[model samples]
Target: MQSGHNAMTGFVTVILALVIVIVGLVSRWPLWVWPFAAGVLSTGAAASLVRARRRRPLIPPERLLEPELPIPQVERWECVIKDVSLPSLSEDYDFQFSATVRWLPQEAPPNAPVVNAGGLAIDAVVDRARRITHQSPPHRSSLVQHRLNGELATMVADPSGRVLAMADNVRLTLADADRERLEKLATVRKNEEVWEHERKWEQSKRAYLGEDVLRTPGSAVVWWLAKNDEKIDKTVSDIGLLAELSSAANDQSVPDDFQRYVPGLAKEQEPLEAMADESTTGPPSPDEYARFLLRHSGLPDGDPRRALYLERVAEAAKGAGLPDVADALLRMLGDFPHPPQSAGPAEPPFDGYFDEDPPYDD
Candidate 1:
């Protein structure tokens, strides 16, 4: 408040000084005397206002108290029955016991139980029924609760009384809130497992299959030299032969024999060599031709071939521990590319069932 008053006093003093100067210059009527008097009065008023405001304490704005959020309440009941009053046990008693349970989906619908209590156990299905009703974990987070939720709603009763088996086989009917919380926990656990699997897959990506096969000709043969029943001979398979047939080294087009086998693919050797040799293509080519051989080499068409290929692939995979690389090559061979003419959108088959069928009347 004092600072505001001081500012107003200073503004007035400046205006008065300007007026006095103008009057003195135009009419020489003691304007300088007016400015001095105005300046002194304004200075005194501004200082007094500033001092008064400085002595007072500042007041803060008042705020309203916010309301508290409502809490959810659920009802629970527990009764202890200690009074034992009964008619004579010699007569058959028609005791009733029932239990209802549903953990997931469409469970058996709930029904009442008719219990017969003979002396002793009496194979108590009704008693079992009651046990079923009360079997789930009280905290309701255990596997026991989930298991019970998925069973038949049943009963067993011995007219002869049995102690409650409170430790197992019962579940609570979840109200909306509790069910939502439990299901959320299940979802979180599922996502964590998925994330863990995804991480393992990613970590295993770089050196996945075929890394060893890239080193030399018939390299899978060289890499798995240690662990073979007899030996995995690259000489036995046509991988080397196919490579030579398709090699960019061949000045001619792919041979007819190669065409007969792989059709659209020029024996795995041709376009592959062109793409593979990093030295020929550049410092870093797309992939090595040997890599294709490693992948496509292990998959034979028939039983004996498939058997042989699996043997080789297993050995190579173990030796190199590069399943990822082998996988890429295997995928390429299995998913051979098609020419535009043969690969265009397929035509839908035509059928005229209505013309050959009975009239529309029904």
Candidate 2:
């Protein structure tokens, strides 16, 4: 409107300038009048040129006929939710969560229903975090918090798609007392597992010894041989003691075949005259006692029992600080016969002991 008014005024001024020039020529006006007319004409021409340059171009009818794009309407806001308590996997335990939530409402039509974007954002972020915390124990709140920070760091649209929300600086925690209790409980559970393992090991050991190794004198001999195959001589010498120990453990008497090897059995059957002779001699030497015991046992010189009885006397001599007597008895054992070979298949190398039922009834 201003540009048009300026153009009209300039046109009128130009016409007046033309009339003045014509009148000056026709009526013999003064030279000053011509300069005034010329000045007026130049001013009008400048005004018209300014208006024409400033004018906007006209739009084509087809351009106006095209459809116009709708402008998007987005509402963005932020809020801080503090001390939000959420349940955890454990009963009587909850996670305390706090974070800054930023929300961006999705673009909708002008007639779309309006909703509380801030509340939706808070609910979406809190609910998403709650799902993770609910599956995690109270003691693992820090770990769960780390996971939430990663998951909620990005904007995620709500289920209804009305708003997108994101969380930052997420903090999940448990009460001091609850955290301490959980730590102690974890320690206790770990110790319980160790204790259970040790208890099982002890039970297995007892079963192996009671039912397999020491079930009988013969079984004890075989088990000892499996363990100390290189010490065959020593095993043969300890056979008497092993048989005695096995019998005592089972609350049974030593087998008759092994009675001669056991000192307790041989001593009970010794004659009074022999005891008197030992009294008369004050006390027999270790070698003499070994020979006497072997004779009373009725075991032959090459019998393993002879070596076993001699070894027992040798151990007694050593305990009594008689090295010379012990050496003599050991030399006697060396002269004894080697153990008989088995006619059956050779036993496998001993890896470890295992439990099994005893061969005989209790």
Candidate 3:
């Protein structure tokens, strides 16, 4: 508007200047007046020309067809599926899953069939998680949940490509009862391992005793000396007892080499001459048999060793189911006399002798 007004004012000024020039000429004005008029006409013309050059030409009205509408955009939506039950590798056990899911519907051609976008998104996310959970044990739900979180954090195009789905804050859980059962099972497995190891140790110990340490009286003595190097005398004294224990453990009689150390043992091994005598008036009674065995023990009357021998024989008779003979021998042992005080402190009885009886009676 301003440029057009300036152009009109300049045109008016030029017209006025031209009229003055023409009137001055027709009226025969002074030459100075003509120069002034010429200057005015020049100024007006210059202004008009400058204004016309600065003015912008009108732009034709743009074609007014309605603005083309942007293709309607499909907005992404969010759906949360919580407490969904999923199967696990363990029988009768299921995983509980929950997640916040976001998805976008795929661009479809016109006349496309209607579909459930939210349902498809949920199914896609759940199915993707199930693929992992189904292969995992119920007790490993936390680990599987971690894996699912990483996988579902990124958007994935569904198999049908109808929608893109992603998930966050994923969770998986197992029943408390199942978790407890797994813990107990693990404990039992560990206990079973311990028991197996203990059993093996016990068997090894038995084999060592039977096959190595106690194989014979000599081996037994060697083993005892190795353990008690300073107890040599004690070891020698206990050799007979060790032999007896070893024989008992192996279910055998004492070795002949050791029989002399155990009084009454050699006599027991020999057949009774009185029993074989055809002229014998009758079989000896328990008392007579006990006295005969005592006499053959080779330990003299009033000797502490004799009492020890009697005690051992009684124990053996009792073990052999001869209760009457055992009783008779015990009575004889109780009646056995002790040596005079002048004998001094009697030598300590050997390990196998006088186990329950005093070396001397008071």
- Model 1, stretches more than 4 Å misplaced? 1-130, 133-156, 159-172, 209-362
Where's the lowest-lDDT run of ten residues in candidate 3? 57-66
Best by the lDDT measure: 2
**What is the TM-score (0 to 1) of candidate 2?**
0.53
Models 1 onward score TM values of 0.19, 0.53, 0.50
| Candidate 2 lDDT by residue in tens digits, 1-362 | 55676768777876887787788889998887788778867887777778776876587545665457676887559999888999999998888999999999898657878889889899999999988888987888878999999999999998778999999999998988888888899999999999999999999999999899999999999999999999999899989999998998898878767877798777643443355676664655555555555556767545676766776667767777788777877877888865666699975533333447435656
Could you arrange the candidates by TM-score from highest to lowest? 2, 3, 1
For residues 1-362, could you state the per-residue lDDT of candidate 1 as single tens digits? 44676677668777877766676678766746765766776677667676766674464323434457576785322222221222111122211222321111112235634432221221232234335434343234344335433432322222433311121233333345545655787899999999999998865652442244323333533444434536546334444444344333333444434443333454444545565665675532223433455445644333345433443454455357566544544544453432234576864433323557856775
TM-score of 3: 0.50
Model 1 accuracy (lDDT, Cα): 0.43
lDDT of each: 0.43, 0.81, 0.81
Q: Considering lDDT, which of the candidate structures 1 and 3 is the better prediction for this target?
A: 3
Greater TM-score among 1 and 2 belongs to: 2
Give the residue spans of candidate 3 off by over 4 A.
1-74, 109-112, 262-362
How would you encode candidate 3's per-residue C-alpha lDDT over 90-207 as one tens digit per residue?
8788898999999998997688888887888889999998898889988788789999999999988887788899998898888788789988988999999999999999999999
Q: Evaluate candidate 3 by giving its C-alpha RMSD to the native, one decimal.
A: 19.5
Return whichever of 2 and 3 wins on TM-score: 2
How far off is residue 144 in model 1, in Å? 11
